[model samples]
Structure formats: structure tokens, C-alpha cells
Target chain A: MSDAAAQVGLPPVTPEEDHKVSEGKGRAFLGIPVVGWMLIFFGVPYFLLFLQSLWEPTAFGVAHNWTLENYKLVFLGDTLSGNIYIPTLLRSLKVGAMVTICATLLAFPIAYLLAFKISNSRTRLMLYVLVIVPLWASYLLRAYAWKVILGQNGLLGSVLDQLGLENTFLNNLLYSQTAVVITMTHIFTPFMILTIYAVLERLPPSLIEASKDLGVGRMKTFLTLVVPLSLPGVIAGATFTMGLSSGDFVAPQLVGGKNDVMIANQVYSQFGATNNWPLGSAIAFVLLGFVAILVALSTQAEKREQL
Target chain B: MINAESGLTGAPTAGAPAGHAAAVELDNVTKRYGDVMAVEDLDLRVEDGQFLTLLGPSGCGKTTTLRLIGGFEAPNRGEIRIAGDDMSSRPAYKRPVNTVFQQYALFPHLSVSQNVGYGLRHAGVSRSDTAQRVAAMMELMQIPDVGERRPRELSGGQQQRVALARALVMEPKVLLLDEPLGALDYKLRKEMQFELKRIHREVGVTFIYVTHDQEEAMTMSDRIVVMSNGHIEQDASPAEIFDRPLTAFVADFIGDTNIVHGTVTRIDNGHATVDVGPLGEIGGSTDDDLKSGDRVRVSIRPTDVRVEAGAAGEAVVQDSVLVGGHIAMKIASGDETVVAHVARGSSYEPGANVHLHVDSDRIRVFAAAEGA
Candidate 1:
């Protein structure tokens, strides 16, 4: 063969072809392992759940019917001993919204302090440790501990009584939506602080100094510069708190009375006490739908901000 | 007595409008961080509309001096004045100056226009006027298309221009640029130097630039302050600082020079005769307070040492290396070694025993005590 024909037979000469070959090799190396892992772990479980959602329970076992009855019952609500779950769904959303707001508000100042004010690395580490230490304790134990604290003659009530504030404590202390919101806020506050603090820590100090040099007062700089820059962390914290609080059954069960029992409690009751797997799964699907919609909205908002 | 005429004179153009008055003055300013003094007794006067550079080696307190003037840090002692007002206790936000940091420090989340409009917005300028000003500033920077682009989307040079536009939009009396071109590559940095000079001229604001690179300082500044060890070694126009360095440190720091130690044997008029051992007698002018028989170090710039074959003048060439545009030759007498720059394409070889003629007028004399 001539030289040109020989070269052409060996490989294509274009830069694009060279790029494609390398890219193909790279994709094969990285893509196969990740897709495999996702399929085995996440995709398979989600597929099974999807299939189960469409299945109807029979005397022998469950079988696929692919009916919309379960979804309808979940959304429209069905009479369960003449009581419906709509109120519980609303209560769960209310508790989630309150927890998100409370945690975000409480986290901002602590995160600001950790990121901007605290300079010593050891002290920051210590503060982070303190924030995460509560997670080391059993979640059930923490819920039960709140039960002791919020009870009629618990530590808080005793303190109030000792301080001669028994009337105020008794009137608004426990077993209400406020109590549930407050407990959930406390439980999820660390997540908010940590997420916000992580974002704030990555912010360059020069940006703040530049603002100051540009005649921006301290408060204005914080509002205009620091706050907007940390929106990602705020979103992350809010989504996490909302997801956790909406699906939580433990805290409400331990400290919450009838009015504060969230949708998760109803699902648990349907599955365990009422022995209604289909209804429980339906409620779970509803919760999952709500979370997915919220997460999708947040992701869209994040994408817009990034662009 | 300090000459008031020289101190307060405006630019030379007669019909041209006088720019704003002096914006910043550092009077014997000293800053100490623990045992290390970052700036020691710095006295600098920044003329309005003039670009002054604090040129020095690293750790020579140029940045510290810029920070002190910008109100980012207060001097341990001495007074700083801005617009003839004492700013010793003023915070950065209270100062009538803005700084363009070395890293540009543009808000990564903010668009170019938003970043430039920040100071105006904070100053409570009307929305329409702020928008107009931001647009005009972006146009002036030749980056109108970058108004909506975030900092990360822009190149380093674009980011630098945005930083400048941001600071300039504030209309601060003084603009402090701390190594503003340090992050850019050589070619871009050279381009930005001219751009910065033009911007300074057009905006008519006093600029206090800090850089360790001597060439950048020399190229852009109306006056350069060469500093060493937190002290101002020499403060003069670029030509004067380069040509007439008052100290040995200034001589060595600014450019290549050959220094030789000797003892003064005689003084006549503006010239001093020194006994430089193997080189026999050398003549130079004294910048130091040297008496007869006192040891001194004489400095001659490499460009001032002329090498000629077949005529012994003062020193002999021991070695030579051709470094394009000029031949760098090592000439020595006794234990003292000095380098001379011979013209390129010169017919000179290593150990050729060429005579070195020191330009008497260009030679600088310094007291041996101030060697550094």
C-alpha cells in the first residue's frame, strides 16, 4: 500500500476521531461501574417499590393489578372508622414547614459565627463535634428524653414551677403542633447549621473585605453578600429538615397527643396496628410524591440560580 | 526646610484643571505584628491623580502599607491622613478609598454589572442612575457584554477589569491596588499595566499600587518607593531610583549592580578617591557620610562598567558570558568581584584581560555600615 493508504487503514487521521476514541475508552472505564452500582442498589429497589405499588394483595400473596385505586384512596382519603387522614396529612406538612423555618432561622446565626467569627481551626472542629454529638445518641432515646422534658411534671415543668411560672408552662408546654415543631426544630437544627456553615466556610474572605472597601456597611454586606451566597446551604438545610420532619413518627408518638400525630404515625398504624399494607403503602407513596415534588422544585430553583 | 512649592505643586500643564488635593499621607507610620515589624516609620505622600507604587521584595511591608492607607489596619504608631483629615481610627467602610485586591475579589455570585454597582447601591444612589453608571463603567472597561456574566465565567484579565470598574464606580478619592496584576501571566500583566495607567489618568484618582516586581513599578508609577525590611530604602521617580540609588540595598534590589569595598583615601570637590587594592585607585561620588580613611562600598551599575581590550584602566576582566543584547563579564581586582555589561557582538573572550573603565559619575558610594 502507498503511505496515505497505509495510514488511513491504520486509523482515521482527524482530531475528532482521536478524541472520540479516547472519550469512548474513558466512558467505558467509568460509566460501566457507576451504572452497575446504581442499578444494583438504587434502580432495583425503586423498581421493586414501583412494582409493589401497582400490586394488589391476595390470599396467596401480592400480585400486579396496576390499578389507580390505592392512589385515589391515598389522595381523596377513605373512611377509617369514620375518621379520615386528610387532617393528618395537613398536620404533617404544617410540622414540616415549621421545622424547616425554625431550623433555618436558628442555623443562620450559629453558622455565621462558625464561619466568619471563629478563626481557630481547633475551636471550629470542637463546635462541629458538639453539633454532631447528639446524633451519636439513640434517636428513640432522644425522642423519649423529650417526652420526659415536655411531660406535665418533667424537668421543664419543674423548672417553670420553681421559677413560679407554672401557669405559662402548663398552658403551652407540650402535646401541641407547637411542641412538635419545636422538637423537630431542635432535632434537625444541627443539619441546618452544618450545611450552612460548610458553604459559608468556602466563601472567600476577600469578597467580604471587598464589600467593606466598596463602602458597604457591615449589616448591608451580610444581607447582600453573605446571605445570598449561602442560599444553597439554606435550600439543602430546608429540604433535609422538611423531608425528615414530614416522615418522622417517633417524636410525635412519644410527645405528641392526638392533634400532633403526623401522617407518618398514621402510616405506621395502618401497617402495624390496622394490618392494612395496601393503605400504608399508599400513604407512603403519597409522602414520597410530596417529597419528590418539593425536591424537584428546589432542584429547578438551584439550576436557575446556577445559570 | 521642606519646599512647599515642590510638595504641593500640581501637574505641569498650565491650562489643565488641577485635580483633587492630596488624598492620602502616611507620616512616620509603623506597624508591628508581635516582634516582626511589617512597616517601619513609612513617610509617603500620594499626590492627587498621580500613580505611586510601593515597590519592594516580599515581606517588605508594601501590602501592609496599602492596608494601613485603606483603613484595613491601623498603624501601631504615626498618623494617616486622607483628604487632609486624620484617618487613624476610621474603619475601612468609613474611608473614602477602595482597594482592588490581588485576587480581584469580585463576588462570584454577582454579575459584572451587579459587582460594579455594589458600592453605588450601598451609597443609596437611585436605581436608574446606578444602572446608567454601571453600564457606562462597563462600556468604559470595554466589557459591556460581561454585565450578566458571573466572575467565574470571565478570564483573569476580564476579572481584573471588572475589579477596576467596581472600584472606579465608587469614585473613591484614592484607589489602592494591591498586586492587582500579580495573578495574570506575563503578557496579560504587561497589557494590564498600560490599561491601569490609562484608567488612572482618565479617572483622575490618586492610586497607591503595591507590587514586589520592580519592572511593573518602574513602568507604571509616577514615583516608586523601593522598600526593604519594612523600611523605605529609596523613594524617587523611577529614573532617579534606578540611576541614583541612595543605599546599597536600593542598588542591589532595583537592578543588577557591581559593588566593591574600599577605603576613602582622598576627597576632592564632588569626587572621592578610594584605594581598591588590585584595581589601584578608583574615583566616585559619595552618597554616604564618609570621611578620609573610612571604609566604604562603591556601587556601579553593570551598564556603567565599560570593557575595552588592550587598555588597562581600573579593573581586569576575569570571565565573560554573552547574554543577548549585552555581554555580562566578571571583572575582579584582588578579592572584590564586579560584573560589567559589554555591548553585544563585542570581540571579547573569557580571561582576555580586558580593561574595565568605571563611569565616575554613575558610581555610587555608600557607607560600609549600610551594606544591606
Candidate 2:
């Protein structure tokens, strides 16, 4: 109990009581603006999209008559195109997983070096800025820059041609699924590095030394001790990339081939050329559902490890 | 002047038998951080199963020497041998030695048993055997019920024991502890000191402990190496360190004492007569190759100086400080002052004349050296 509480002849506030008071009075009302903002900007639009998905699309405009025809077309497949929605959504997931794996693999070493290996603060600061400076450039420009490099006569091809290795490196290098993965991995790596670096920076250095002192070799110590301790950060970084890349439309549009189109591309086409807002909103919500489930699972896993 | 090698005495413990093999040896080791020399031309040896302590103030190079032995830091010019094998080029991971860090660096993510069994897992011990040994080690540390608890959930004392258990479970040939009790409160520090000494006796490993606490060193160490300014000032048993300090620095650092400045008037067989300006002539033991007219300081433990009330004495009682079991009174004669530790409840008021008697056999005379 606090001295003030004792002097006032009142009981000290327990955590449960404090929580109850916060939930009971003006403090609870403080959340009104944030909840209202989310509802007006997000909740109402999502509800309207759900309603629109049930309405039928007429030639001139959306009909007021409610039906499941749009959902049926999305699930059973378009009459002419067989099962493109499932395959496209699955491809998006695969791309998100691939990008997340590659980014995390490439980020751990850089984060470890930044946090522990570099002894000088000034040098570490310079390297930190180097990692983040790429994010300062326009994302569209960076994506386009990769497009130029991966194209047939771009940097890799021209360099290979100059070396007389003409057709060796050209096949499927440009406008392919691999191209999308590569570009997205490059763009998402800094986020992973920063997250992992933040965790590593706070880790006590003596813990590593203690492991080594107890007859554990360097490599084993890293695998057993360092990796498990840093798993939360790795999960956090993977969550960011997974959430962002699964719904990404820009990278695939600029660098992907015909068969490499993701679900976001289909949704974009429905809203633009097809003028089918109902179908587009349905696809968007489905993708959002998958990403939301993954994020929740990862965060829950992180919390479990905290104990 | 005080010299490094002259103050060293033989190991006084009964555990180290004659011809006992050295578990660790450092020959003229030197370590430098940039241009600053953290340890300089240091040579030391530890007997197998001996509990040795490095006692010094902060920045006294004691920690650097421990690191040198643990292979955490390589010496610029030296040869280190562990169990008669040269370990100068070996890294910390390959060396058969372990260290309990100052912060008790237990793995926060692992349970107490997992932390204790970590090194065993690396060695490919069977799961059952690992569990058995971890349980036994935890039992030895008196923390049998904390195996499933994470380090963050344990008390400071429990965490320290867990760290000890973690390192000892590896069964290393030597254990290095860097101020392991420094983070605990006074009462806990004292308790852990006894706990560490018990563990040392039970395990019979060569334990190299470091601390700046003189009382801790005196209580727990079989031998203590006192360091100052990147050099070994005195290396001997704690009793000798307190009773027969070879230099003024050793005497002043180890415990409370009254130092009276004087110069050697004559030397007779191992005993020297010195003339203190205000207290007149006094005779004490000397070992600094003293000659006539050589400046020196006579060190007397406060308990050795007897105070008697008198009106025609050379000294007068200045004040009496009440320490629980004893009263430490200051006696001033002209410009010289000396403290006498008397029994509690002695009522010697200020301004009372007191005749001071010096225990000549217990007094230590060292040459007054500059920058010691």
C-alpha cells in the first residue's frame, strides 16, 4: 500500500479495481472518438460491401434485388474460366510465404551484425542508415527499377551478353513469378531487419558469453540460445511481410507474367475494367480474412512464448 | 619502497598438499586496451581445488586477469596453461573453464532445469541423464523446487544459485566467478559468501573468485591476491594479509589500523627501532631491508594499542566512537594521532590524558613509498 493511501485512511487501489474504475467512468468514454472514427471509415464501408455482394449486378447498374449470384460465380468459377479465384488466392499466399521466408533469412545476419558484431557506435549508425535509406526512395520507383533490371535487355542481360553468356540467364527471368518474389523480398527485408535488430539490441551480451563459457560451441549456442530467444522478433517481422505481400498488387502487376497474377489483380480488374464492385469487394474481404487469421495466430504464438 | 614480489608469502591452507599441481598458470601476462595497460606483466598460479580470490578496488586489473585465465581475453605476451595444457590460443568455448558473470546471466527464456542442462545438451547427453544431473545440481544448490520456474520469476539469491548450478553442471576443471555476490544486499551477500564457500568445498574445483570487498575475501578465500594499479601488491593468506601486512598499502586496505610515520634509527636482527616524532621511540618488526635514516611507517592494528588513563602521559583522548562490540577511541599526542579499540562501555571522555602502550611484536613497519 502507498503512504498516501494510508494517510488518507483509504484502501490502496488494486490492479483489478483500477481496471474496473477505468472501464466504469469518463475514462471509458475517452475511447469514443477512436471507435467512432474506425466505424465511420471502416465498419460502415465493410458492411455496405457485404450487402453489395448479395445484390445482383445489372447491365446498367447494381440491382436492389438480393441474391448470391456473385458469390456463386466466385466459388463455382466463372462460366468460361474454370476455378481461377482459388488458384489466384492460393498463388498470392504462396508468394507471401516465399517473400517472408527469404526476407527473414536475409535479415537475421544483418541484424545480428548491427546489434552485436560492430563495436563502434558511429559505424553501427552508418550501417543502420544504409539499411533504411532504400525505404526513403519512392516504392513505385524501386519496383520499376527492378522491372528495368530484370527485363530482357536490362542490366543482368546486358552484362551476361557482354560476357558472351547470351541466352543462359534470360529464360523466365523477367515478367515471372520469380521476378515478383525477388522484388518483393528486396522491398520487405528492411522491416524484418529492424524488428529483429530491436530485440537483439536489448539482449544482454553476457548471456551469450555465459553459454560459451558453459562448454557450448559458438554455432550450437547461436542455434539453441540465440535463435529461440529472438523467435518473437522473427515472428513479428514475418507477420509484417506476410500481411503486406499477400494483398500486394503493385509488384505482381509490374513484374509478373500472365499466369502469375494474384487475387489482388483480379479484384483490381473487377473494380476497374469490369465495373463489378460487388465481386471486387468479395475478393478483398476474403483476402483480408486470411491475413487477419494469420496475424492473430502469430501474435498469439508470441504471447505464449513470453511465459 | 614497496616492491611487488617481496610482499608475496606461501599459501597457508592445509588442503593444498606439498607438490600439489597447479590447475592454472599465467606467466608474465600483459593485456592492453588501446594504449592503456589493463594488466601488466602479471604472473600467477592457482593450485588444484584451491579457493583463491582476487581482491582489489575497481579498475585494479583483477577482472582482466580472470578473463585472461578464462580465455575470454588473450594476453598480448604470456603463456596460460590449464591443467598443464597450453590454452593461450584456445577460445573461451573450447577451454575447460566456466565463468559466473557479475549479473548472474541466466537464460531468461529457459526454465531453471533447461538452463542448467544447456551445456549437457550440447555435449549430447541422454535426456534422462541430463534431467537427472540437472535435478541433482539444483538439489546441490538448494533450489529443488525452482526447476520449472524461469529466471525472471526467481529471487536474486535464487538466480545466483541457478547460475552457479548452470556452470557447475558442466563439470568444468575450473570455475571463475566475477563478483557473483556484488548484486545482492549486504545480508544476502554474506549468506551467499558462505554458500559459495560450501559449494567450493563440496565440488573441489579450482575456484577463482574476484571481489573488491576485503571482508568477503577474508571470510571465503583460502588465499587472497591484493591488487592495485594493474599490479599485484600483496599475495598471501588472509590472516597474514591482515596481521603481517608487508606494506602500508596492504595494511591500510585490509582493515582499520593506526599508521605512525617515522624513520628507522637502527636495525637489530629482523627488528628495527624507529623514532616517531610525537610518540618518541618505538621498536617493531621490519622486512624492507631498512637502513639507518630510512623513512618508514609503523602500522598497528587498533586492537593492539592499549590505552590507560593518566595525567602525565604523552597522548590525550580526543573522542570515542561506539561500535557495537567495541569502542574505538582516538589518542592524539602533539601532531600524531592513533586509534585504540577498547571494550564497549568504556567511558574515556575527551580531554583526558592517556598513556598509550604499543604491542611491538604485532606492529608492522614498512618503508614509506610514494605512489604505492
Candidate 3:
């Protein structure tokens, strides 16, 4: 609509047409390397994994003959074990749900305080650095550190003993599902806080003022205004936490007790100790299916809120 | 020459309706954010249904004063009352005042109807009653068709109307608008001005508008409070403000006027004869407290200016624009400048030689201001 460009003898392009021009023809070569890399490294592997899920596993090793027996085992369960595949996968989901809820509960308050309450920019930045600082170290180290802290002779039990509280209860903290949940929650909370804070930071202050101006009280305003506005961020964070935690094997291996075996650990053992790649790939698809549905539903919810 | 136009001849509008009270009052209220004193010991009273505008440049505390009234910000000192009730300790939601923010902060996630109905929900109104009120308010704003659209989908002007509708739907005791038309194009702003005035009349709610646009202030306000450096310089009708500014800041800010520094040489009643340095002696008028020996500044409106290609003057015609009904000329020499609104037929080239002339009696002298 501006005449300046036309007056300057330049062709005026609508934003839509301009985007098309940038994306089409000669510019297509610009994305070739990244696209080619994704197809080679990502696309080919996932395609091969899909094929591996359908192949036969003989007594010696994986054979060329294709069969649906591995998929049947994924549904029918391993007769040698007490339905461990389906049960472990379901347990993984429950843990993922637990980690997601706990993480979001802890993250929202921190995000809100940072975005709205802390007016000092330097202070907020310092706190944000503190939150993400742990991500710099190895993820395994953090998970392993939790095992040490939660152990009977370690930090928690020793602290309890120092405080003269019951120390025996601390022994139950490590090497359990609770340990897995607690460690994963601690590890995943920063991502949730970052995502929620990004959206909450962009919330226009005027909107809150306007809501209050209209006679909506502070709590009501937060529920009706702040919560809805931050839903996309919450959904995004929840999706990541759910997807990663449900498929996670490392935390379960390091912190999980004998009964806390998860689907990802089984997926690993099928390839390593068991030497049954076909069953592992088939089991992996079940996890993929659940995570895929969660992601797609969250994305739809996010898109529905957009203008 | 003018001094309060003698009696401020721009007769004040009819006093508030009988039995009507002030809808909002700020008594010696001061608001400070960190080191900046945004509003200082300010007292203001907006009468019921009065269209009062706080007109000033940015950082003049006009918007801050509006926010205090709307309870968006509590004062650092002093009390604010709405409908004769003290509102000092109350938060924005507890007060009976609403604000249409300068940016028109409509709820982007909600549809137009939902946005309008949001505040009503807290009123504990029935669903049908909320619906009826929301529909009526939307109809009043002329935005009924956009009920299902989100805030971003609407045009700027439409969003402004929706904001107004959302606030007014609450039937708050006072409505504060922080330059509601600031983001609109000039043509749309002019149109929205009339729309706003019409809405104000129909609703009969007190409107406290804030804007730095003097023309907008002049065209819309029943009373305009001119502010400078967080203090009020003048609070009067638009005509009085335009004709009889009390300070050099007010005169300079309100119109296209040339301020010429001078010293009073003689006084007759409230009128004075001043020595305008290079411009020589000129007869003008000012407040009686400005004694004959006091330094002064005189204001000459552009309409009072006349230029012709005759004797050599201090300034040459710098530029001229044909502004519909008149030719606006910028004439300058050294640090001194003058703007003259000439007849439509008058034409002057950028570098044309000219002499500026003004009727000596038409200049208005003001007492010199301090560092403020």
C-alpha cells in the first residue's frame, strides 16, 4: 500500500508473493545441503528401522526372510517374561505423565515470577542462566548425581541423620520409580520453564491492566487471561517432557530398581544382550505411535489458539 | 494581544448537570517510578459525563495521571477518589474505572464478543444478560459483524472500537483513554474522534482522554489540561487555551506561534507595552503581576503574521506549503524563526526576500518561565 517503493521505481511485491519468490526456483539450492543431510542421516535410518521391524529373527541372527511374528510378539508379549513388553511400555507412559505434571507444576510458577515479577533485567538474566547451567554438563552425570544424593549413605540420608529425622526412609528414595521420576523432573524442568517463560514474557502488560479495568479480579484475570495465553507454551513443554521421558532409558537404567524396567531399556536390551533387533524395532514403533499422537494433538491445540 | 482574553472570553461550558458529582478526583496525588517523578502533587477532578482531556507532550505525566485514576498504578502519595469514594488502596479491578489503553490491548485469544464479555463475567451476571449486554455494546461500537473474529483479524480502527466497547460494557463510573486514536491514520483518527464523541454522548459516561496531539485536544475536549514537565501549565477550554495561553510553554505548544522574548517597558491596567529587542517596541497584554521591569516573552499566532516583498527583514521565506485553505510559510534567519499562515492566493518561493509584519497590539506577552 505504500507508494514510496513504486515511486522509487522498484517493483512492489506482496508479502505472500515475496515469500513465494524467495522459496521458488533459483533459491531452492540454498536448502540442498541441510535437506540432503536429513534424508541421508534421518530418513534412511527411520526407513531401515521400519524395515527391520518387519524382518525375521532366526536362532543365529536376523535373516533376510520377512515376517510379522515380531509385531505379534510386541502385542502378544514375550512368553519367557510375564508380559514385560506391553507392561513396561505402559509403565513408561505413566512415568512420562508423572514427570510432565510435576515438571509443569514447578515450571509455571518460576516462569511467571521471572516474566512478570522480577523487574530487574540483570537479575532475571542471572536466574535464567542458573536454571540452564546444569544443561551444560553431561545428562548422564546429572542422572547419576541424583542416584548418589538419594542413596542411603549419600546426601539425603546423611542430611536426614544430621537433622535427627528418620534416616531409614531415605534408603527407599534411591533405585526406585520415585527416584526415576524425581531425577527426570529435575532434568526436564528447565525446558518447561524456558518454553512457558518465552510466551509469558511476550504477554502484553496492557492486557492484564485491561482485564483488571473490566473488573476481573487478579486471580480470575490470571486464570482467564494469563493461563489461556500461555497454553501453547505449556502444551509445547508438556509434549517434549512427555515424549522424552516416555522413551527415556538412561535415567531408568541408572536410578530404576529391578522392577522399574522401561520400554526404552527393553528396546536397548533387545539389540544388546538379547540380540533381537527385530523385536526391539517393533517395540520401538509402539512408543513412537504414542509420542506421535501426543505431539500431533498438542500441535493442533496450539494451532487452534493462533489467529 | 491577549491576557486570559481579559476574562477568558471562551466561556466555560455549562457546569456539570444538577446533582452531578465528580466521577474521578485525584487530590495531591504523586506517582514516582524509580527516580522519575511521573506525576507530582497533582490534583484533578473530572465531572460526570465531562469529556476532559489531559493534553501534553510525552513524559508530561498525562498518561500516568490517567493510569492512577484507572487504578493501574497506585500513587506514591496522596489519595484518588472515584464517585466520591477514596480509591487509594484499591487495585484496578476493585475500582469503578476502566481504561482504553493507547495500544488498544484487546484480548488476542478471544473473539470480539468474548473480549467484550470478559469483564462482565466477573460481575456475576447471568449468561443471557451478559450476552444481551455484549451484543448491545458491540452494536453501539459498530463492530457487531466482527463478533467471531480475533483481535488481530480486525483493522486498527475496529480494534480501537472493540477496546472501547469492552471497557464501556462494564458501565464503569469513568472511562480513561490514553490517546486511543494514537495508532490510527490521520483520516481514520479524525473519523474515530467523531465516533468516540458520539459514543461518549450516548453513554453519558465521564471520559478522561490523554493525548499530546493539540489539534485532537482542541477538536474533542470540553476542557483541556495542558501539562509540561509533569505539571499543569493551563487547564481551560480549547478556545481559551488557543487564545490566552498562560505560559510560554503553553503558547508554544498549543499552536503554530512565534515566541519573541522581550522586556516590559510600560503597563496600563493589565495590558503592557514591551520592548521586543530586535523587533522594537510592541503593545501587548499580560497578567497584572508581571511588573513593568520584568523580562517577558510574547506570542504571535501564525494568522496574525503578514509577509510581503517590501523592506528587508531579518528572515527570508524558507519554505511554503499550500495547505488547502491557506499557505503555511516557514521564514527563518539565524536562530529566529516564524511561521505565517497566509491567504490561499499568496505564493512565495523558498528563498524569496520578505519582511515579517504583525499588528503590534495582537501580540501576547507572558511572564518568563524558570528552568522547568
What DockQ results for candidate 1? 0.56
CA lDDT of each candidate? 0.82, 0.87, 0.86
Candidate 1 — which residues are off by over 4 angstroms?
A1-43, A58-66, A79-87, B1-21, B275-280, B309-324, B327-337, B347-353, B370-372
**Residue pairs of candidate 3 with colliding backbone atoms:** B1-B362
Better lDDT candidate (2, 3):
2
**Chain A TM-score values for every predicted structure, listed in order:** 0.82, 0.87, 0.90
How well is each residue in B185-298 modelled by candidate 3, as lDDT tens digits? Answer: 999999999998899889988889999999999888878999877787888888888887777788889978888777889988878888876555777767537777788878
- RMSD value for candidate 3: 7.1
RMSD of 2: 7.6
* Model 1 chain B lowest lDDT segment of ten: B8-17
- Across residues A1-307, which tens digit of lDDT does each residue of candidate 3 receive? 4377789888886888767777786677779999999999999998999899999987768897889988889888666864668888899999999999999999999999999999999999999999899889899999989988999898888888899998877767788999999999999999999999999999999999888888888898999999999998999999999999999999999999989999999999999999999989999988899899999999999999765
DockQ of each: 0.56, 0.58, 0.71
Q: Is candidate 2 or candidate 3 better by DockQ?
A: 3
TM-score of chain B taken alone, candidate 2: 0.92
How far is A145's C-alpha from truth in model 1 (Å)? 2.3
